[model samples]
Target: MRHLFFALAPDAALRDAIANDAARLHLAWGGRATKPAKLHMTLRFLQGFTDPLPDDVVAAARAAGDAIASVPFAFELDRADRFGRRIGWLGCAVTPRPLQALHDALTESCRAHAVPMREEERFVPHVTILRDPKRAVPSAIAPLRWQVDGFVLMASAEGAYEVLGRWALRA
Candidate 1:
């Protein structure tokens, strides 16, 4: 069993923009910025499991991905926030309804497959950009608008992740 989750990775152009902002923030506040390659918006975090993921679980995830009828959606980052002393994340002031719908669909799919998931009363969509920043400051940078067209199922191990499947959002 392997650790798995569903996430949305930005295209190269958008990744570059986010990375640039992270670099600037790092210089100003002194923290570890997220690596350019590791930046992503997590849709659903499925906790760790054994090495080979069970076939039923993978099928369920695929079904969930297939159920999503949402088209491409856009979200914009409007502020930088610190969750605590250690975590600095980029917050999206705009909540896209489509994103929520996809998340809900995935959650329901997990229930259908009996896959354990992280329980949360509310889902906050965020992309972490820094860690252990010395200081938190108001972010006045231009909003980073991201156009999300698809999502990927990723397997994580030893602090690294590999994309196992890509699902496009369609009508």
Candidate 2:
């Protein structure tokens, strides 16, 4: 089975800035720092697809992207928090409406394709900083604000998630 999701990737400059912030926060809080490569806020997680995504899935994702008008939104990195048992993440102080809308749209598309989705509670959008097993809490740093313009479709490959495509918001 394949795990899929939609997300926004930070550009090189922003990635560097966030890494620096993570480093400082790690030093202060005595937690392991997150690698810059894995920083992104997920819109939805479509779990348990038996094969590669069909064309309809790509079309639906593209349609969802086309429907969204680009808006200026910024995410500010907040303190560290653990979700449930094994996941650790950097909290962000940002309204989740945009991400939630994307999630709902994608979920609808998956349903339209007769793809079975993992049932879960309401979406609480978050960027993962660490995953699996327990990790120390990173210290609070001055929030890093980032502007988002687009989201990407990603798939699980060889035990790691890889980007499949990126869809930019229409102006």
Candidate 3:
């Protein structure tokens, strides 16, 4: 059985910057901060399964990822907000079209593979910064830039992620 999802991971330098910024936000908002190593922008979430995914499903994912006709795209994190009383997130003021396209493609691939996904009312792309927040503290953040080059398939175990596959974004 494996729990899997697809995400775009930031490089070490950018991860550091996001960690530092998240730390500052935690200081002000009083929440459980996200661990630096666990930070990633989720593209699509596939729930757990009790058996190995078929080879065709994995191949579909790989081919879908490879077919993303995009160069690297940049995004800016500009605000912090809460999903409720518990989860805190960094919001982007601007999301590139390529990013959205990549997400849509991955989602379509998952559908094609017969992978079941949760029904989310809306898709708001953001990185989680904290959990179990004390209160709602929406704060303006300095615009932080991220250059996304590729996305990866990751398996989850005991609150950590193991990378299963990676596909670069190229046109």
Best by TM-score: 1
Greater TM-score among 1 and 2 belongs to 1
Query: TM-scores of all models?
Result: 0.88, 0.73, 0.87
Global fold similarity of model 1 (TM-score): 0.88
Once model 1 is optimally superposed onto the true structure by TM-score, how far is the C-alpha of residue 145 displaced, in angstroms?
1.4
| Tens digit of per-residue lDDT, candidate 1, span 1-171 | 577888989899988988888888888778888889888888898767887777777777767666666778787877777777787777666567877887888788777767677677787787788899888775646888888889998877666778877988765
Q: Which residue pairs clash within candidate 2?
A: none
Lowest-sum lDDT 10-residue window in model 3: 61-70
* Candidate 3, superposed: residue stretches over 4 Å from native: 50-60
Please list the C-alpha lDDT of all candidates, in the order they appear: 0.79, 0.65, 0.78
Off by over 4 Å in 2: 24-34, 50-70, 93-96, 108-116, 132-135, 138-140
Instruction: After the best TM-score superposition of candidate 3, give how far the Cα of residue 51 lies from its true spot, in angstroms.
Output: 7.6
Model 2 lDDT per residue over 41-118, tens place: 777666556677666765665565455555545667666666764566665545556556667776776666554456
Clashing residue pairs for model 1: 1-50, 1-51, 1-52, 2-50
User: Candidate 1 or 2, higher lDDT?
Assistant: 1
Q: Write the per-residue lDDT of candidate 3 for residues 1-171, one digit (tens) a residue.
A: 767778989899988988998888888888789999999988888767655665665566566565556677778878788888888988675656777787887787777667666566656788898998786578778878888888898877677888878977764
In terms of lDDT, model 2 sits at 0.65
- RMSD per model, one decimal: 2.0, 3.4, 2.2
